[model samples]
Target: MTTPPYDGQPQFPPGQPGQYPAGQPGQFQPQGYNPYGQAGQGQGGYGYGYAPPGQLAGWPIRVGASILDSLIISIPPIVGVIVALVIDGDQDELGPGGGIAMVTGFAVGFAVWVWNRLIQQGRTGQSFGKKLTGLRVVHAQSGQLIGLGSNLGREICAQIFNQLCILNVIWPLWDDKQQTWHDKVVNDIVIRL
Candidate 1:
């Protein structure tokens, strides 16, 4: 029997999806076949996992956001520390309240951090500081807000990297995608709204 001429359709065995035919090395690929699993530039700007879309927020703006957030979270704790000191007032030791005010202040500050960084930022893509700066943090691939769990991990990584070296914060200055180490770990990008 004579074989049929190639009609541009992949010849797959029955019960198989339109996958690339196997054992036919260098054969013509099916339409829309992407070995990398992402569409080409014509489809959707190269899809995800390669390049994150949207205009990246500037480093200065990002730093501003960080500073703003830091100040907001620190206010309570600083006030508590100041109050505790004033109460002690040259005493050899802490006053009757001891470190209660300081502890309470830190707790409040931690709560604020959780709410702003993990909860709000995860759900809305913007923490208070980012919102004020007209910026957002989103998944690098999906271009959507990273969830709370991811935000938590990202925050932990950020802390660790920041403690390890100040480069983590400043790395974005010269990065092609402006991603810090924590951002890379979480597969995230910062963009201006």
Candidate 2:
């Protein structure tokens, strides 16, 4: 155990200068201060891709939104049909044309489709009913939310796909990653966007 020139002061070993002296880990020598070290590196905080979210909330959120959207959009047509019914009795009018059943059906269908399309078009990518229902359409490679043209493609497929015998709706279910058949055709995914 070497001692300092003063006799008992703790000193660094002959070869190790900046290292802790002796067995005392707390004893350190001088080095330049690192006040800015690791700056912007996020060492003291969450970095990129630190942790992924545990649960997916797409379906639940979209389902709730659909109910809300349906209720809200259905109001106009419902009111229109009621007014039409009172005015025309069995006639057609400005509020809605034809008998109550036909008028109501037309109004409801039109309002629903319009509202669905508008809302879907508002987001990062367009998703009609199924898209709004917790499923996102994105490019396969970039994993990015689809843009205008692709989104339009997806929306069109989704809308008319109702007639494709089950292939229309069931495609997403069969996808390895849960993408719809329409998604496959469009090179997209029904993922959490």
Candidate 3:
């Protein structure tokens, strides 16, 4: 019997329609075939996956936000001190009323700071400072809001570093990821909105 003539198209083995033949060097794989099984899935941008690099909040903007937040958080306590001084004018010691005023002021300020920075930020990813600065804190990998645990951890780490005189707020200035020590500890990143 005469052998059939060779066709122009290359033949694939049975049951392998789009796969390249085994042992074929330099052969292009079929379109849309991803060996890692991630075909057609794009990397997430913001709020789902990590924001693209180079879009993180810069040090200057973050510093400005910190300053603003500091001023805002200090207002109540300053007012309280003033009121205490007025109430206790010319007194060598602070009376009970003056003490109460000072304590109340400090407590109110502390409560406001905690609410804004911890609770609100945990739920919404933005503190007052972050909101004003158009920045947000998110999971570094997932780009989701950092929850209360992460937020608290971040704050604790920051406080520890601050106590150590390490200047945690300025850490992002020299960090490759633009993350402070607390951010790194919590696997969080601050990104522009």
Candidate 4:
């Protein structure tokens, strides 16, 4: 017996008109096709039944992660300011040593922020808080980790949106993908691991 010739189209029946085949062989499938059963990526095909990596992280957990990260980054600066205040007690102007302490504190805090949020998260897709909370940030369409440059830009946008209004961070509460304004800025999504 001879098998029937197969076109590039899928072995299964075709989907609705104008839609790409379920599992066309390519490194990156079209936006509307999903052979991996991931959310919003596209419909899965019979070709390979791969499980989704994760579900969208909820707003509450994301908020918790944010708070945790804020605390982590705030500690150094707050401690420094406290030390400066102690050193300059009852003095209107800060002493040289007090000023140095305050500056050092702020610098350390900034370094921590950069390491935790920009470098680590950019490389692993999970900041310290996100790792603790079992969440990861990834490209919205590709489900891959974003690079450092994108992470830096995303952080800048996050700061702007956060300063603009509370709604920017709170957007994830009602967003379809549970994405904050910053996540949207970088085309990223937070997923619960």
Candidate whose TM-score is highest = 4
- Across 73-179, the per-residue lDDT of candidate 2 in tens digits comes to 66666776666676667543443343565567567767675556544553554435445554444465344556666766766786677566666655444344344
lDDT of 2 at 48: 22
Per-candidate TM vs. native? 0.73, 0.47, 0.72, 0.75
C-alpha RMSD between model 3 and the true structure = 14.5
Which pairs clash inside model 2?
A: 58-134, 172-179, 172-180
Looking at model 1, which ten-residue stretch has the lowest summed lDDT?
Answer: 45-54
Cα displacement (Å) at residue 190, model 4: 0.1
What is the number of residue pairs that collide in model 2? 3
Per-residue CA lDDT of model 1 for 3-59, tens digit only, reads 231223323442243222332332222334333344555334231222223357889
Top-scoring candidate (lDDT): 4
**CA RMSD of each candidate after superposition:** 12.1, 18.4, 14.5, 8.8
Score candidate 2 by TM-score against the native: 0.47
1 or 4, greater by TM-score: 4
> Cα miss at 37, model 3 (Å)?
8.8
The per-residue C-alpha lDDT of model 4 at residue 192 equals 82
**70 Cα displacement, candidate 1 (Å):** 0.5
Regions of model 4 farther than 4 Å from truth: 1-52
lDDT of 1 at 76: 94
lDDT of model 3 at residue 107? 97
- Alpha carbon deviation, residue 30, candidate 1 (Å): 20
The segments of candidate 3 whose C-alpha lies over 4 angstroms from its true place after superposition are 1-50
Q: Cα lDDT of all candidates, in order? A: 0.73, 0.46, 0.69, 0.74
